[model samples]
Target: MGRLGVPPLPNHALATRLADAYRAGTTVVLAAGDVPESLDAAEAIQDAWMASLGTSHAYKLGATIPAVREALNLPRSFYAPVPDDRLFRDGAAVPMAIARQTGVECEYAFRLARDLLPGPDALGEDEIAAAFDAILPAIEIPGTRYGRLAEYGGAALVADAGALGALVVGEPVTGLDPRALGAAPVRLSVDGTTVAEGSGAVMDGGAFGPIHAFVNRARARGRTLRAGEVVVTGSCTGYEVVARGPTIAAHFEALGRSVSLRFAP
Candidate 1:
């Protein structure tokens, strides 16, 4: 492990090569059992990958729900950076060529108005909410440059930016109530059919829970949550794989907002 408690990266060349494949929009898979076993090692690989891509414009939390954690065999949640080029306005067209296996996540996303500097103490939910300038509906497109995500393990997923392919953010919701927002209902549909549905209650502490978790995680890694950065909380509807399709949509019922994406063949 590194001085910060993250494991030392065992394969810098592999990390750089994967980053290059991501940038080139090509699929590349590592040899079997080549993934990191510890969070620190995974974080180190992710840091290296992000450095090759340039600064991240947003962040995403993964495996926040019990079902997802169990599915990934993870004991807890994790965070990953999203490159700026991967963020898209609602209704943007996403080329299918960018990812090998595409999936969708319905989530609530926050855009921070003030910088959240790292400190010794963790921030509470209310404090996390106070830091956000806007709350919006979001559709997260998660994909893997690597083959068979389940074969690689959670640490490998973390290293590949939580398998983030793109983000589609909706219009900001006004008159936000923290309590109601936490319990808000969310649904995801593709090609006019409902594929997954759930509530904000599935989130760790409602909508703001993941933000607090993210802040603490960032601090643990000797980083800070900056202003003007968008943070996508864990999915309300678990990750649902998407076939090559024309469009995908997510609706935040209580928040009264929706986001959509069109996929190109």
Candidate 2:
């Protein structure tokens, strides 16, 4: 490949690369592009095509809803988190006000316990705020940029919502303690070497805020947050890519087990 500035490959070629990756069950991270100024129809073409596959979306950007809109074809589709989906976990969500960029680094995100907004039935503001308080945690990861200093924001709110699929991790906790919840230590390894280590506590304001925001957005669009939805808050640690044979593993210490995923060409 030429320099990053070189013209992008033809759409067919790009689609082939994405399709192959998806078929292999390997995760492919894409930068949700900035819009109007950087809005390339070709990029959206690729994104739309990818949604047909099993790829998932992440809202890493924190505050930039418009940018997220441009990156993901939101107005064109509705987003609801379902089982077997994944995104970047363990890192903080980026705000929407800045102009920063990051390369496609691989990361694994956690899914929320329920679908934020389901169907076309939306809710009022008061109802939404209470929902936010109900789902989010209180800890934060304290940072704005990733390893490459790319300005990340809440990408979930802006990306193609239908692309998400949550993995069925046993069952949801019902009578669990919320106030005294401790950060679960999760060990992440790349290529068999521990590159990043983090915990559930790494998420800012716990996981509820994002859920609330997501639900509110959906409700605004006349959607309802349904049960059994998946929401990956952010990355505990920034993304780390694997060029050759890298195997990524994550062990949620609280779960007393580990899961491994690999990147392949």
Candidate 3:
């Protein structure tokens, strides 16, 4: 749905259009591909885009403590695929794998809205607040973009062919208090049983700092950070690799909301 039907635009072009639409106070979302061929292309595209955008890259957490990391035995690196915009508009399934080295865990963070905020960059708090008015509750689907820690460094890993995962836009979290909103406990359940837990504290003690930093990094590049853009600062907790054939739910405790997801083989 971009550029007057020009082959639906390449993944990179589609991503730019999604950001542009968000800046224009319009919402846009897309789907993601799990196929290795498509995954490789998507990751390549995102690495180039992030580099061009100069956005800061970081992983989400499942919880706030080291104890959780010990429990999951997460690896330092992960595999990720570039997601379509629709997934951002609606909740989507995310697949992840644990690494044998680095022992780093990964988690998913739900960030809605297409608005951007002010930071050391040009926009100020009041301006940002005003722009955020049209924000929506878009979900951020994060997974292992990179294969493993031994495979590459964080930046390199993300730049690699397999580092980007699906990014979708889902239901808009209404009445999200930008000022009052910060980090808190986030929970996830599978078949009514808790499978993952995380906290907002992982995002630089709260959502503001890290989210701002992320946007600022993006702004540093050629792209302009607009208002009404919602971004999930990063994972409050690390990654939680789920098993096959199960129903999953992610809850943002601080906000008192939850999203249900169905996974496919």
7-48, model 2: which lDDT tens digit per residue? 343344434544454344343444544211222333333344
Which candidate do you rate higher for lDDT, 2 or 3?
3
lDDT per residue (tens digit) for residues 1-265 in model 1 = 1123456677787688778878777766777666777766777888777766767768888888777788777778888878878888898888866655577889888887788765567777777777777778888888776765555777778777778778878888755754457666798888778888998788777767766777876876667678878888788888788777568899888877889987776
Error of 2 at 203 (Å): 3.3
TM-score of each: 0.89, 0.44, 0.55
Per-residue lDDT for 20-76 in model 3, tens only?
A: 432343433333342213323433444444343333222222212434334433322
Q: In terms of TM-score, which candidate is strongest?
A: 1
The C-alpha stretches of model 2 lying farther than 4 A from their native spots are: 1-34, 37-181
Each candidate's lDDT (Cα)?
0.77, 0.36, 0.39
RMSD of each: 2.6, 11.8, 11.4
Regions of candidate 3 where Cα sits further than 4 Å from its true position: 1-121, 134-146, 226-229
lDDT order, best first, reads 1, 3, 2
* Clash-forming residue pairs, model 1: 6-40, 7-40, 7-41
